[model samples]
Target: MANKAVKVGLLGLGTVGGGVARLLMEKRAELSAYLGVDLQLARAVDLEPARAEELGLAPGVFSSDSWSILEDGDIDIVVETVGGLEPARAMVLTALNKGKGVVTANKALLASHGVEIFQTARQQGVGIAFEASVGGGIPLVRSLRDSLAANRVTSCLGILNGTCNFILSRMTAEGAPFDQVLAQAQEKGYAEADPTFDVEGTDTAHKLAIVASLVTGAQPRLDDIPTEGITKITPLDIQFAGEFGFKIKLLAVLNNQGGKVEARVHPALVPHDHLLASVEGPFNALHVNGDWVGQVLLYGQGAGRRPTASAVVGDVLELARDVAAGVPGRVPPLGTQASGGRRLDLAPLDDARCQYYCRFAALDQPGVLASVARELGSFNISIEKVTQKGRQEAGPVPIVMLTHEAREADLRGALKKIDALPEIVEPTVVIRMA
Candidate 1:
């Protein structure tokens, strides 16, 4: 008897879609042998069919309209790699309604509409696999959903966005400014022209929200999470951080305190010897700490055509195997029970407790440090170490302070009072030390 053929329909032919198509064809024999099922590409949909041709796809396999795939009877799996929220959202929902197992690499859509998407899949008794959404080919989602399923995830700290990481890495290494390195990242194709989403920490926050929802089973409100960008970081700050045994990296943080989850994104001063601190350039690393599993670190190329394609195709194979075994919805879309009804409180940023690296550009006159210290002491924000850089004579002197563990609220209050002082020349730079 001939092998059972699991037909797949691809809904996008962009970078990741092209890579998935190539991988499916190139690894057909290996995948078929491993899954004990033959995978076949029935149709590929893209606004530009020329991308399919550019990838050397067969003439009959590519189409300009997605309706053909959505309307097809033979497509058992629909892979959607379209990045945005629009047509991609409509296509994924429609495919699920049609009883087709869907695989997607749309993080933005999933972050914003995951509850709706998962609910639809559950109601329709179909499967949706999104391993490619969070960490590209790093397998972080599978680890959280399957491998670490037994443990109570305590916290997840990661460098989730490559563009920000690359820019920060360049700035730290060369002691260059943010604009220079950002321009370099854009020229090298690591950053987008606008780069606002990635640079402003929105991208990292989106990934953090997804990871938090999956691990805690409590879908969080994305807007409530406090977010900060890396644009304020300067080479002088980087130099000061190094002198204090810390490196600044854009971090996505999700921590479960008691039962409430804290989700935030910002530039943090990581100790130089920390594992996440070494993750440089346009790479991503996630450090997940669980009660039973202890610390687990996953690192890899976070994005790019083939890297992301590896994850997209992995989801396809899993879906194919599940369909062939007649267990289409064996695992839930989030690999857990539906959490749409669960309300996870996002801990306010002011409640956080951590050490801080505070830099103040103040007048060289005496009592400047005394005034700042007095205000900090008023809030019980005791300093662990304080250093004043050599005077430049013409400009405000730089005073860097590393504080012991202090409540974020106290630190902010003290900084606000100090900033109002006439002696303070520039806005203080307050970076949390992890």
Candidate 2:
């Protein structure tokens, strides 16, 4: 039976480490039966071997030094759940060079040094399983990389970050503000010590870049993806969006326009009826549009102990099986080379047009509306409807303008000029119409 036991070396015993212990203990027989290989935690690598044992390490199998396992001739697979770039990067690189298959859930590591790691693995003739990198335990990365490999992906978009989504959902549901909801989320451990990555959209951007690379085989630079956060999204804005039959969502959108791809993240006005809008709570969802599969929505836990650990273990099993079968060099969800890939600006937004919702508060004065409309017309932007609200409880009078389809640059330019107007009471709230 090819010794139904696959000896695995594990790295890091954090929250996910404990979860991996539970999963390996519980699902060992099932996994072994499935692959005809007993997955054993042959060696565990952690800073403090005692702490790793605290998580219930099997007897006689422990290592304070991860290098021992990396160099251990008996180990068949290396499962790295360690989150970071430096040591994780060096560790994965070393293991791959040693011709050991690696399985990891480090999105940051994968996002930054994926091409280098993937190419090295290819050269070493080993599989690198990272199914949990994008959608936590959802297996989306593997699906995109293997199952949908043949399909020509048209658009990849989603609410990929849980922290930001939770805050935004609270702002919409309870009519609460951003900072307040954010504080609560932090208190609840939904946010990080430095929530900048999650709130500022960089986290989602990282996932999008990885997904884009997988779909396009071209690793796009992080800075190339134009990103906007949800910090500016107000409760009133969310309310108005709902009233107008739209739901607000922070979406990381990737589109393949001809030979190029455009990746961007921003607070968007998605129709309530659309599946993305229905996604609520501290959950993550991805929408992949393919020529063959059409459109598929994958929704699940974006992070945390068991979910992330399950993904890591799943990757571990895949690597174990692939290595045993002597079929290594499995490509990642994204086909990334160390240095050959180049990112091309897709300029896809220009191709996809939409109506815009603008809120401009001007003083109670005549010719103000006409002047604002005229300024928008300069860029060939047309206003479909103009609604002048009576008066705000505080501040300037409110003037909401709904504009017809126009390019984003034109809309932005028109808003900038309107902001400079003397008649305008305050800065406008402009959101893309659903």
Candidate 3:
């Protein structure tokens, strides 16, 4: 089996698919040594005929329909990179039904329909490996689900989306606005042409959902996990957070508090020395808190053509090794679940108790401070520090306050009273001092 070549069928020969094909064509011997089996790209599928020919793929092997690739008699494994729910999901189901192993990078599909897909594969006794779906090519999914299987993951923190991380990191680094940095990321191919999914933080939410399911032994439904984006992070707020010894990073946080799992994605403040605070640029970092390992940080490039393709091929080799060595059930079903595990509720946007950093424009009245403090004190939220800055010509002087651990709802309630005060010229800008 060490010298045996395994045939592979690929769906979608786009950027990532091209890289997978390139590896099979050029790096077969290199991969063979690692997996103990030669890998062959037996067939490739694409929607465009000219595009397939443009890449100089074999004449007899190209198919516009991906199902034809899955049904290929000679192919043992199917690699899905077409993305989206429609044909990609249908194609993967067909391959699994046919007892052919599968590898995919579709986070949305996996997050939404993974329970059914994994159940089907588990019943059929075939593998569905998806290491590339989460952290680009970092292999965090396998690291948590396989390497750290012995330990219980107490919580998982991630800055998952490269685009969101890049934009936020840039806004903090260059002091450029989100829109400006986003335009630059789009130009650099770090952001998509549409960029909605990446910037809105739903992309991180989807990835986190998958991570939660893989780590918790339960399929995490997307609706159960809440997500927040970085669009509202202002440079002023960034500066304010910096004064308090923190760096803002878009974080996907999943925690097991008591027994309930809470998943969220948002801009969070981490102390400069925290491992995740240093994950700058377009790179991703996952800080997994295991009961035994305590904490492990996985960081690297989270997206790319070759990097993503490298993950897909790694899945191919993993499946090939299992088939060649008759290793049964060593690889768990992709995002598999246990019967007792349930989808945990998403922590409300304003439920958790976190230190608050808020700034407001207030009239420099002597009694104004007392009025503001009373409002927050009603909710049992106390101010730790208050700094009144120079007056502004347009309104009251700016008052910056750092609060002790306070509920988000309490802060929201107090802000309502403060906003209505004549002393307060404008609304408050608040962020969690994570």
Q: Against the hidden reference, what TM-scores do the models get?
A: 0.97, 0.92, 0.93
lDDT of each: 0.89, 0.80, 0.81
Error of 3 at 272 (Å): 1.1
What is the lDDT ranking, best to worst?
1, 3, 2
How far is 199's C-alpha from truth in model 1 (Å)? 0.7
Give candidate 2 regions above 4 Å deviation: 331-354
Candidate 3, which ten residues in sequence have the lowest lDDT sum? 334-343
Prediction 3 global C-alpha lDDT = 0.81
**What TM-score would you give candidate 1 relative to the actual structure?**
0.97
Tell me the tens digit of each residue's lDDT in model 3 across 52-76: 7776776577777777876676688
Cα shift from native, residue 181, model 1 (Å): 0.7
Q: For all candidates, what are the clash counts?
A: 0, 5, 0
Per-residue lDDT of 55-113 in model 1, one digit per residue for the tens?
78776889888888998989999999878999889999999999999999888887788
* N/CA/C clash count, model 2: 5
Candidate 3 runs further than 4 Å off: 1-4, 334-351, 363-366, 392-397
Residue 328, candidate 3: how far off, in angstroms? 5.4
